[model samples]
Target: MDESLRAFLEALDYDGEPFGMFYTDQEPPSGFAPKPGPALSMELEQSGAINWQEVWGSFSCVIGSIWLARKKNTAAYFEAARYGCMGGSFYLGFHQPQLDFITHYVSTGIPGTQVHGERYLRSPETVRRFFTEIAPRPAPKRFCVFKPLSQFAPGETPETVTFFGRAEVLSGLVFLASFVTDDFEAVMSPFGAGCSYLTSWPLHYLGQGRLKAVLGGFDPSERKFLKTDEMTFTVPYEMYGRFLERWPDSYLRTDTWQGVRKKIARSRDAWGEQAGQGDGKD
Candidate 1:
């Protein structure tokens, strides 16, 4: 539950459903490393006037539909995946400055089913369609929002964080990063589980460049609560164990959100830049 994301939603007037959540920038008194982020106080500058939105997989059409796979509703899944791929997943051909990005949680509605996994995997085509289709070529919105929430903050409390957006959906970000440098491996899985799906098409075939994924997984028991359509996103544990052993100071940088936001906002210049709109404009 990244506070910036929560604040961004409220600022965006997502007040209809009034989704409620309890969050603390600090972990519980018990022994848990919390998620991988920095301290909340260091997370953002808290300009108080800053405005941003966490628009991960809000392409509801493709999303909620994936849950229908269990109902033999692959059509709904494909439709949703198509829209999300062409829409939510990519940010190309824009003139905005780089924007913000980070792993965060949202208490989004669940459609129910396992195809959410498929949707996550097959997202690029639709992601690029938006840049190719929909137009007037709207100006990119201001405010860069990223996530990975810990417990701590004024008016923030404790509650289980439900990961709303699916995983690996941000492969677009990974692909875009390839254009600038070879740090693509910075986000790849050690076992290569996602590499093929990651590089299956031109979406990621940037010709040259790579990133190192500090990727790791958790154990099933460590998973708080997961239903039939749910997955714990676990790993062998040994991989991350090495990460902690080597760099004992990377527990989710709450403090880095603002900086991360600015960076993505800058990168937007290359991906989602809107030629005439000024970054400072409303």
Candidate 2:
């Protein structure tokens, strides 16, 4: 494991849930429990904060619904999906390398009946193509990736990391990174697996231009986690929405999709007009 990752693991509360570090000058909300760290800077010429709650809620609605359908447990799976959606947005997205590692594990690991597992098994070539395509893209120039830290300061608490950036672009990066790595086998392994979802939280404001945040996954598996590689991309929010809207039909049983749709509809009602809506500014 890398020294930074080792240090981060050492800092964990042990009893506390897994956590990732965020680097920013802004005073985070009380829930965020900001702590002192090295002063880092970035040049984000074209980035800004978007309505993260809306983005997250929509993502949860779609993804959660799918999980619900697959697991055939509306109550449990929906809650997990809700938790994942909120948690991912709160964290500054998953590290690209971590996401890639998880993808590699799933694409090459055992096959199963779940959507992610079966899909990869059906088209290993397609999965390979995806990784190849994303591997060459540069990390987001407008965002700073945070180091994962396990510990919270004496008074610090784990809370959402605010991100500032183009919602459409960030959403696309997150969605694609997630899509290619949705490996169920790793997730079901006794060793915990990295999360597939990513969120872009706002970190700080630098005069006219604010710094955006993007972090990666840190699971509690016994395996030693380390950063291996980096990849990033962007897809329009509208495009993501369309994909999510069609995902269940394409991958799930009709009966399951119908049941899941009802839950999604309820979530949409609660989140108002933005729930599951496209990334195009409302």
Candidate 3:
């Protein structure tokens, strides 16, 4: 992590460290990989009972594991065939779901299959259109690694850097992102799975040669793994460097942001995040 960015985040009272995602051939240190197997089957959806332990042999939500990685200060990774969820697999460019079931599953129910719709979209057609428009890119390497920014070694570049924070922290991030570029839509909030925002869309913008930030964590299913107050801000590494260059001169340095910082302190104290720990700034 860059020292300037670190200090800026600290001053903002952002609680957690930012994490990075990258594709690599070699495994990462202390990385948590999805359990080995044939991957989840839709047949299990219709089965009487699912012994998930017998199925995947462990807890498996791609975003959930990423949460674990952040809290534990470790790394999490996924392989092409071993990604746990069919939706996550598709988003990660590992493979498509069987018979395009994700479309219906995310929208309307598939009648007679025990598959109740999540109602995230209006209809299956809407989901299909989403898939068509996004056109996620395939994984570039054998292993997709996610770890905290501090863990990244020299020569290892991350495709995306993801931050988890409440609205105040995100506000700083949003303004700083826009300060680096003239684009009116410097930050984009697209509808997607938590993993899609953290991984897919940021990479998508990078692949298209556009530098933009992605505001995410709106997925209802993945909210359980995130703090009640938290959302995500994901950006391409190049954009992150721009933030490093511009934040010293941005509004983040002004008394206006300092007023917001006091509110951040209050929120953290109310939530017990600063329990008994004096940051010494007070």
Most accurate candidate by TM-score: 3
Give the whole-model CA lDDT for all candidates, comma-separated. Answer: 0.25, 0.28, 0.79
Q: What's the candidate order when arranged by decreasing TM-score? A: 3, 2, 1
The true-versus-predicted C-alpha distance at residue 270 of model 3, in Å, is: 1.4
- Residues 14-118 of candidate 1 have per-residue lDDT tens digits of 211111122122323322111112111112424433222212233232222322221221222111112222222222112211112111111111246322222
Better of 1 and 2 by lDDT: 2
Per residue, candidate 3 scores C-alpha lDDT tens digits across 15-51 of 7678889998888768677776455444644563445
Which of 2 and 3 is the better model by lDDT?
Answer: 3
User: Which 10 residues in a row give candidate 3 its minimum summed lDDT?
Assistant: 273-282
**If scored against the real structure, what TM-score would every candidate get?**
0.20, 0.21, 0.88
What is the Cα-based lDDT of residue 14 in candidate 3? 72
| lDDT comparing candidate 3 with the true structure | 0.79
Q: Measure candidate 3: CA RMSD.
A: 4.4
lDDT of 2 by residue, 54-82 (tens): 43344432222222322231111111112
